[model samples]
Target: MLWRPFGINETIPTTIGALTVLVAGIVPWMDVLNIFDIIRGASLTILSTIMMSIVLESIVFFGGLL
Candidate 1:
């Protein structure tokens, strides 16, 4: 979404959405390998989930704010 259309704002909600999805995967892996504690992983998961929710809200509320 950032560069695909050439001028899409990289700082927009889509960025947060994509970043959270990536974190969802990376955090779990970090936890499984003992790089992150259970608490850290769980918190990160929650944060990512919340960010995803916010993306939906932004889409509905702003309606293609780009």
Candidate 2:
């Protein structure tokens, strides 16, 4: 039997997509309004996703020890 963390499959793709968005936000190609807001939101999304993954993995690891 193979053991996989919950949402592992979805997490990778989501993180990748978020990173792509973040990069796009960083590039200043157009003089659009609220660009900073876009960058901030994307950064927050990436950070939260990473933090959530860490927490979930830790929980799974500790739970397995019990």
Steric clash pairs (candidate 1): none
**Residue lDDT tens for model 1, 1-66:** 424565666677677885787687854654555744647878899999899889988779646557
The clash count of every prediction, one per candidate, is 0, 0
lDDT of 2: 0.72
When superposed on Cα atoms, how far off is each prediction in RMSD? 11.7, 10.5
The collision pairs in model 2 are none
